[model samples]
Target: MKEMTKKIAVLGAGSWGSILASVLVENGNQVMLWTNSEEQAKELNEKHTNEHYIHDYTYPKELITTLDLKEAVTGADFVLFAIPTKVIRPVAQQLLEVLKELSIKPILIHASKGLELGTHKRLSQVITEEIPEEYRSGMVVFSGPSHAEEVANKDITLITAASQNLDNARAVQKIFMNKYLRIYTNTDVIGVEVGGAFKNIIAIGAGILHGLKYGDDAKAALMTRGLAEISRLGVALGADPSTFMGLSGVGDLIVTCTSVHSRNWRCGNQLGEGKKLDDIIQNMGMVIEGINTCKAAYELGNQLNLTLPICHAMYNVLYNDADIQEEIEKLMTRPGKSEIEKYDEC
Candidate 1:
């Protein structure tokens, strides 16, 4: 790897953002962790702990937290979008406003996942639309199975650093890539983007099965069938089926579904156990992407005229006031279909 010194600006002080910032500073990069609250900035820069969001971890001296968007990105060599999916739009707009003076561009990496609900556009599409076209050349997505909780402690993780620019992708791959964190490169941003967003749905389903006290046998079946649904929807959207087998696909789906750390899965577990969405969110104090994603995926399937049976069942349960177990029974009692349908991208 080429010797390098860089400045990293991590937008969003959530668990993922802080963990990523810690990783950046550990790599000897100057990291400015951006937070929305001025109070959070003070806490991060002074006490080194962000109690309001990700508690218990204090940042090192090299890591500085700031609320000034421009100050954070002034000379940054790399930018990571770790904010939740919904806030990405206004946040990117904020970045564009701050970056107007810069003719020279820095590498852009999005660590966030999901599509804009209404337009059904991926985060990469939104980034390309918001940021200057000049910056588009350096855009990449660092996505995969690493959860924020595990990543903060520097546990072994693997991810995809995908870009059309092989050189730029390799640079990102090397920056956070370590013995514990393996980085894979992909030219199919569409595949990586779609896979990451879609997996959360299956994760929610996995959580439901667990919540219902279904044993490993049932959970395994749910995951396998869920992977089939994911590949089907992704391939219909022009992603390569082979990409479905890789880290951003199967690896991510498995982790999110199985891990208690997954918010989406937890949300589904609550629903399965007969709790209200409003109550669940109020208790957790964080957004559950899968709940909203269930709606998005359902609408997108209708638009595409694709038969996402699994998603359809999930949506029916979520929005139509359909009985949850009835939906499950509905799926189980369906007419027998060829087993090969699961593997084929139709």
Candidate 2:
């Protein structure tokens, strides 16, 4: 099939959104980057760089950015939400209102990776709830081990485009696939979403280990057990067990935990070094999804009656102000069991 040019509005002019906008523009799409901050939008349009988010990388000159919601979404072929998970609902609501005014129905793609705080709803769920059924062409989540800073520099990155609808997943795959960036499509939205959200928690723990001067042996053990914990909760919540092994699952988990580009890892590293959560967050000047994801996953695990010890340990450190070393000891001292407990019963 011949490639058709598209007009894509990428909401949230953060690092990820800006990277997506740049990629779409490179693919010959008319791209508009939307942000709430007029000053940031103006700076992007004029300077072709989002210095605050991704350092040392400049956006393509053709990439357009706007603060006007109506102008961004009007007649857009696809709307990609790359904003923080916490504000996903509000942004989706605003987009829905704009789409209603323009009478446009476009495919929705979200790259944000965190569950809602109280509701524990996936980012796609929040988008769908805010956007009326008729006005949305489809909703697909694009996730994996992608770090926006590296991706902006055209680093080799692989990501999954996941949705219940195969067509939507494939459509996203087409728009994003390039020589440097590979896109894989999957129908397991639940699994993909779970992997993307929960891995951040594990990454935080990984950072904590690094901060505490733990060795590779400790990191390896934590990652292995962490995957088990993630798979358990995900499978209990209707995700495919094998999805945890895919790019969005173990692949994402590995990268986020080890990379210096990861915000969650950086935050966790600080916490491990005895820094306060508030201080770490304030100094970082970026949204650390793991901080909130830890809380949401903890609540979700309790509700589902799943044992997520690693997640629990991280949650205790962040929310309860529990000692890091104590939580580590608690995790290390946990009773031993079969590695395949979930499947042995099956």
Candidate 3:
């Protein structure tokens, strides 16, 4: 697949989507960025800047933008869905309609991180549920610690390309890997997706700790314990426990929890500072994944009868209007248990 000119369709013009489109264009692919916002499409095409998303980053002049979903996806070699998780199923359903018209099957890749609200399905699961089998050749997940802001700036970054099919994962890696961007292949799709989605929940907790003025020691403890919590759930769901130690798991958790670029962390910081959830959402004007993920994880924990105290605490803060301090105290005061109780299980 080296030096092959492929037509790539990037769904969504959010920061992550725009950055990916730019990278594909840089790699000499024919790239089209699809956005529902007519204004954003115009800005991307004419101004070559997606200021609303990737701040101060100029898109490649060769990159195109279209408001028409069908036009963006028509005859694409690979279709990367980088939209919000809430709309992933709807987009996949719409893509099915487009595929019906074009009669084309392209490799499917998703960079979105979050579970579906009601169904709690992974993004790939949502795509599979909505899109017919004939319309997509393969599905892969592109995730890790890489942030859109840094990626757009051409900072050195590493990401995971995960699929049950190793060939598909490598194909994705071949297209995306360059000097500044590195890609690794993995077979554990469940662990990768689970880690990517669940880390946002822990990131919010990290931000809350930050806002509460908890020092580095407290933050370190949260991250470590958070990894344990994530690994337990991932293992329970049939993911390789070691995947939590990989790039998509602990790696992603570290970046999202500590960085200012993380929307989830920012939302949590606001919450810790005594802002209302509604106000935080309104002010950010972006999808803070952890808020919704918290709900899903809370429900899932209840269904699975798993003890996910940090997730439950965050859920209480967001949904139950519980005081953050009281919730933290509750978490801290929980009965002692072995540190690696679930470690051997994974």
Estimate TM-scores for all models.
0.95, 0.98, 0.98
How displaced is residue 282 in candidate 2, in Å? Answer: 0.4
Candidate 2 local lDDT, 117-194, one digit each (tens): 999998888999999889999999999989887877789999999989899899999989999999999988899999
Clashes of 1: 0
Off by over 4 Å in 3: 343-346
Q: What lDDT score belongs to each candidate, Candidate 1 first?
A: 0.83, 0.90, 0.90
Give the per-residue lDDT of model 1 (tens digit) for 206-282: 88888788789877877787778777778778888898799999999989999988998898888889888678888
Give the higher-TM-score candidate: 1 or 3: 3
Model 1 CA lDDT for position 91:
91
What RMSD does each model have against the real structure? 1.7, 1.4, 1.4
For candidate 2, what's the RMSD? 1.4
Question: What lDDT score is found at residue 158 in candidate 1?
Answer: 90
Which residue pairs come into collision in candidate 3?
A: none
Candidates 2 and 3 compared by lDDT, better number: 3
